[model samples]
Target: MASTIKPVLPTSYKAAVIEAPGAPLKVIDVTLKKPGPSQVLVKVLACGICHSDAGLQQGHFGPHLFPRVPGHEIVGDVVKIGGGVSRVANGDRVRGTWHGGHDHTCRQCHMGLFQICDNAVSNGISQDGGYAEFVLLRSEAVVRVPKDLDPAQVGPLLCAGVTVFNSIRKMKIEQGNLVAIQGIGGLGHLAIQYANKMGYKVAALSSGSEKRDLALKLGAHEFIDSSQVDPIKALKELGGAALIIATAPNPKSIAPLTGALGAAGKLCVLAPVGQLEINSFDLISKAASVHGWPSGHALDCEDAIDFARTHGVTCLVERFSLDNAQEAMDTMIQNKVRFRSVLVMGSE
Candidate 1:
């Protein structure tokens, strides 16, 4: 079957190539390789600029791998399939995981939690990712895109959407529960919408009065400016929040909110962290739990996509052409992007 399909290679396809940590990104022409066994080759339509890529840029996710392409929130169409790849075929719209492929025979995988698989292949860190004209994905890493959805918006949904949605689900947060989503940036903005759709009395927790109006308009029941009035106090006033999902990695910004949890409430940390210091008795007294969630497994990813498609959820993405890779990365670093930044390639 592999021999039947002729290999196609086009010269001078541009890709964002990161040669080293803390260095400027370069746009270079790279040769495309055919799919290997159990791999699918995708012509990227759009890829989101994720903070995980920021971590990759700063060497936080371990030693830097030079000549790495770093956009994991990918939405594209499969262009070719390798031997034994039955999950998807050419021209199928898809989005892929940040953790590319997990060893499915592991105990965690058996339990349907592949994100924590003993051996995981992470895009842009341990493996090549989506900042190129073509991306090679293991068969299990890809998820089908709903026909009605915009591929650009779906890119962020693959990562941030699943992260927040899964965390919200894992916390077992109930409808009508007071839920506060900290940070009103990329992840937090979407988290607010998802929380609202799930019937939570959501509050957008940000640092200033500036974002308050926009947050409320986005379905947050109320907006709390942590810079002026105390956010913990504001949230606590709402019968204490049943859950707080911290999407920002700033430890200091999140630590103070721990005490604001309602009776038996839980706080789920979805973003990466540095250090957070909290009093032990804060949890002991309330019987609350502090849990950390990695990126989602296959099921969670599916649920996120379905929820987004069903509820009209979408990222407010600013699109850039594929050749403007450095500009996109710089926009992400400057925090200038409103919600998400995505690079668009061939026909979407």
Candidate 2:
């Protein structure tokens, strides 16, 4: 059985939209639509500007993305709900990540791989997303989040946070094992924290020595400045990096890390910097494997959130207003955002 609820709401709201490929996002007034069956109407609070949003701006990911509202790292309050909505209700705080709605009929869904459904619909990609005052979400894609967490700070966890946490959680890492995190930015910073909290000896790999203190403060046990020394040689000296999570998108920077893996180690690439060129012998010789990860679904997002909350792991973010979305998106893609860029709509 399902119950439907609708509250007093506005007829229209402000939203940031991408009109076409390579175009800057512009704020515009959008008429609101009531939630349909198995759907939710959320009052958008905070949404992070992720680097992958570039895919939306460039019309890359979805079949029809023009006029898209691009934002996957969402934190909002449930305002209304259509039938079949038992997981959450009005006033509940929640976060929605990259895994949008899925068509259960897909083969991937039948295999319980709903996150990567064959059709591959996504928040801020195939659908209108959180870069607005209000948005409609399918109940299947909504995850209830805690009320106490700061919307601006925790929003990025929906995407960037979940990606690293979900990926590292799969490694089944053991204590004292050396785990190297490539890059000290958005995904890498959080990866270091998650890896450290998971009982591994965390090393932060970056181009400069300036990030050393910050990386250490974020729970990295050591800092390897690639500019000063060969990271591969350094990792080899440190008994080989048991797991190397490459968070940078530059293929050139990520490819060489295969040589730094220990016996049967894995290099998990979390960034989307296009084609990578690597020496197959490096992986073959060490029994290492390189692979990429997609952000998890709703239940998985909850797990990532709960772990961060319990472990005191925090997401560092720079805030921007909805009016400044273009600047925020530009700054994020340019890698100038402190770590994550979040658009705050109102008081958290």
**Per-residue lDDT of 1-348 in model 2, one digit per residue for the tens?**
122455579999999999888888899999999889988899999999887787778767654568789898888888888998878888888787788889999898897678999876688888888999998888888888888899988789878888899898777666789999999898998999989888899989999898899999999988999999999999999989889999987788899899999998889998878788988998889888887777788888889889999999999999999999998988888877789988999633
Q: lDDT values of the candidates?
A: 0.82, 0.86
Question: CA lDDT of 67 in candidate 2?
Answer: 74
lDDT of 1 by residue, 171-271 (tens): 88779989999998888988998999999999888887988888888889988888898888888888888999998778888887778898898888776
Best by TM-score: 2
Candidate 1 residues lying further than 4 Å off, grouped into runs, are 1-12, 346-348
lDDT, candidate 2, at 210: 82
| Model 2: colliding residue pairs | none
Q: TM-score for model 2?
A: 0.95
